[model samples]
Target: MADVFDQIEWNVQKIFDGEPVCVHVGNAMECELKRHPSYPKFHTEAVRAGVQPASSSRLWESLIAMGRLSDLDGDCTWRLVILDCIIPSLRSVSARVSRDFRVDCEEIRSDMVATALEAWKDTATGVAPRNVRDRMVKAAFDAAFRQGKATSSERPMDDIEALSWQEPTAQDCKPRASSIIDVDDIRDADVAEQIRGERAGAMLQRWGCFDAVHSFHDEIRSGHRSGSAGQAVKTSRSRSLISNPNLYYYSSDLYPRHIGLSEAAGVMGIAESAAHRLIRTGQFPLPVARVGRSYKVSVRALMHFKDIPDAIIHVDDVENGALHARDAVP
Candidate 1:
């Protein structure tokens, strides 16, 4: 059996190493850089281990979002600067920076870190805004997705036939505007059409009116005659094609059911006499008690008597009768 100290160390080591690769969890692979006082030893060790330091842009956003960078305290900024300076030496391998992803990877000077942080604090509330930029970017992405231009090759662009740069003149510089249009008028027309259809459907199903009920039944039975004619149009256009060709019939109405939970509990202890009394009475404070799968006569008696100094109780039977017996302890 492992000693208590050995068990503690084992648990601690497991937390640091994380679950094995077989777990396939996202956060499992992410590792953090360790801070040290000596630069030479730290740099050499980090480089040898191929530990890459996180970039400033990503780190800044993360810290801000986690509320750690709020108020931009001088001490906190200094720590960040130290981490930033050591990052290049710790990085696994260098790669060419692209124009789209380029960030000024300048190593933050230790002396200036405090001043920069203080200046940032003075300028703003030291709080980063709730990322409206990300929301806007996602909206643009969704728009692209809806337009069927998500993939690079599927994007619509005019071919060689539309080229007109050679004949361009000052006349094209004039501002061109379209004719007057009422956006609300278009919405109103669509709303009116939907309302009219709904009202017609309701009138056909009206109660206390024999003609209306008969009309409703007739419409319901006649629906099958229309067959696939009323299905949604699904045709490939010039640049984009309809992805999902399956026609989904509209559901008229639906009501969903709700789910609830029941509370339950299990009890275990060592005193054979006490365990027997409780099992017989079923008087444990825990409201919903059940005999657990792991419950064993010997194990329960030993566990219950563990609280007492010198009492020794041993159970031999593995069956449920012994487990739930009137004299069984824990």
Candidate 2:
């Protein structure tokens, strides 16, 4: 049993190193099976070694079930089994980074793949248990999260806020002067028609009604001529132009900069009820801020538990020094 485990571990490490290994029946034929291509070769070798075909087939099936081998697209590749085990954890790590750091999903996934490749290169020979998936996840996540932290540090938090919804102001509505050609000066009929359209578009833009006009035009093109249909289109267009302030406030202000109880639980990958219990028991690592009936947590404070640098300061912390107050409290 010990010898078999050692051989399996050795073969797995070789697969990680980009070398292929054969799936064999038993210890007697193990020496002859290294890097053999197909099941036919294994069967022939086993039969020559006085082993029955039924025994060899059963052993192959058991190995496949145990994830010691993989038959992908008619080719037996052992490393793919390891990859299958780690893929779900990799996706979870990617989600966590996207949620916490607000990094692009594609960029985070690419970074994780690179991290996995690098880690595989450095892996030593050892008999890892079937549940080594979690370790792979943590390793990949740590690398990707560190890269995300560096990226977040380069971009100011205010930039993220600015990209989110901001209330439209007078400055936003201020129209710039645009020179329009007189339609009478154009000789070509088509050119004159184009100029008139451009002038109309400019006027609509200045009045902040271009989208409404566009929607109306689209409805006309789609043959929705009824008064009720026109009214519905207008209403939908107006709603689309106005950003939802609540969604903006929660996603931009509360999520990344401050960790509320629910947000903290999501970051820690735990249940909201469990997170609330931890906070009430004072077992949560960071200090929670009480803002009226709701609670907020500093992202900086959360970093302390992870031993990461406190690069971010919440807006509430800057204004009310809530972080300092929470720190000062027992």
Candidate 3:
């Protein structure tokens, strides 16, 4: 009864609109727009099928296509596709990755391309394409893992044993000084804290904080005055922190101890005027409590410590840290 294009459009729309005839991030019933960018027409016809917006039929096909779902041939029904081949592939596609992909992060962009290829392979025509994508994804992951691995020093085997022992046995250690400088223990804090004692001592010794501050200051002045910053509000100590071998102890973990320090330290290196400009534009990674021009905009010659939580974070870490396990909720 319907025209062929209309039929094709309707079928496609049904695929997009009906409860995803596949599984995606979760048991969500939303349309699989990311799986098929041209799914709007298909969604329109799904409404005609008496399928509610919450139905999985609308999302399933795209989910399966994206390799986010597995067809349940045994049950003769659709369910979330568990990544059975998890050890070889880290089941890396997740809600966080999906959301980030929607927002256009580089890693997420790479992941979606990987997913699209996997989805294509489900059908006979896409076999070669899927193989190509599989190889690419493996290469990308291998490269990333190696890069992450390379940023560390060769730790003495005994030091690793000590740290590993601390993980299960250490009831959160209270630093000797009971000062509020230890932001890691604070509850409900949103920012990170200062690196005190040995950590700060080492950084100050190796990098010379004042010189680092001046270098970052010059970068900020040059970038802002010359209009060449291009989103990189460069930092000397921050760069040092990233590159330092001493700090590598925390680098391998999800919530690196140093990040808490970096978040709390604020931009001590920049001028108050430059800091104010950077904060207004949200270019600075540090948080600002107020947004008015009258604020002096704290800039210290030494790193000023602010109290923040140990676990407080943005969505970006979800991919960097929590890509394992089944807890990702999109």
Candidate 4:
């Protein structure tokens, strides 16, 4: 865990050092930090404040505000700085959630990081920007709780509000039904995308590629993604982008266009059998096709239906994006 934290820190610093623009921007930010009255007696002190910023700590808010602005403007150094602060808190979250959910702590950690970034973006858009430390942690922790076991029975959507964060107080370690995904009842693409968001966010967190994903999205929007989909999208320009849009097109750059039913099931956080049932009963919302042994689900259509990233991505992506129907995992 410590190594993971250190590696992320090292990577962010390396990126800062490696890029001339980042170097120039970082040097400027460094001077600003030094000039602040909250200028830490020790530099890591600012970060410590971020771990748990006091209500009165204008310094923490200033740092986070700056960091966020820089990140949104395309400089990732500050956001990484913000992420560094949450590592300790996320570790604790990972520990508790992992124990409660009876899953691997590392997976929980990845989810926490992914959730934090999702929270980060959410905060940037609609959430209030103040109260830098506590809110971020709470949001991430709350999201992780819901993002628990993918296959865990999800609570009714109407009950989502009742799934408030609670301190562990009993022997039961099971994740709250609210925290798990249940796309089965999803009636719209937005609902599906929200469920799908967790998986896509997790994938980026695993790849340590938030920066790359942002760049990839930017390239797509800017008409420079460099594939046939890029050209197609550039021409028609109708993709409701992951985490950022309400309209999208089926682009091969996002996927090879579609994926197997089982793989789609994994990404959808539902049982493979349930997905098959959806197809059999004609309830599978996304357009489906029989491509040989398996039913091929349209990744972008699912994305349009659900609102996720990586397809924002499917995990099969890491290993050649192949998932044939009944392809036995050896």
Error of 1 at 268 (Å): 52
Which residue ranges in model 2 land beyond 4 Å of their true spot? 1-76, 153-265, 269-301, 306-330
Weakest ten-residue segment in model 1 by summed lDDT: 254-263
Give lDDT tens digits, candidate 2, residues 1-330: 333223434554455453333444322235464544343343344223221222233433433433432333343344343443344445655666666577876677767656654554344235233213323444566777687777753332222222232345664454322123444556965444333334334433544444554554455445553332222222111123223211111112222556577766565544455445445544555788888867787764554544432222211212222222223334
Residues 263-301, model 3: lDDT tens digits:
222222223333443444444434444534243222221
Cand. 4 Cα-lDDT: 0.50
How many residue pairs clash in all the candidates, one count each?
6, 0, 23, 12
State model 1's lDDT: 0.26
Q: TM-score of the candidate numbered 1?
A: 0.15
lDDT of 4 at 93: 55
Q: Local error of candidate 1 at 298, Å?
A: 51
Model 1 C-alpha RMSD to native: 30.3
State the displacement of the C-alpha of residue 85, model 1, in Å, after optimal TM-score superposition.
5.7
- lDDT per residue for candidate 4 within 104-170, as digits (tens), equals 6666666667777777776675544545455566556656556564623433221111111235454
Error of 2 at 190 (Å): 61
Evaluated with lDDT, which candidate comes out highest?
4
Better of 2 and 3 by TM-score: 2
- Model 3 TM-score on a 0 to 1 scale: 0.19
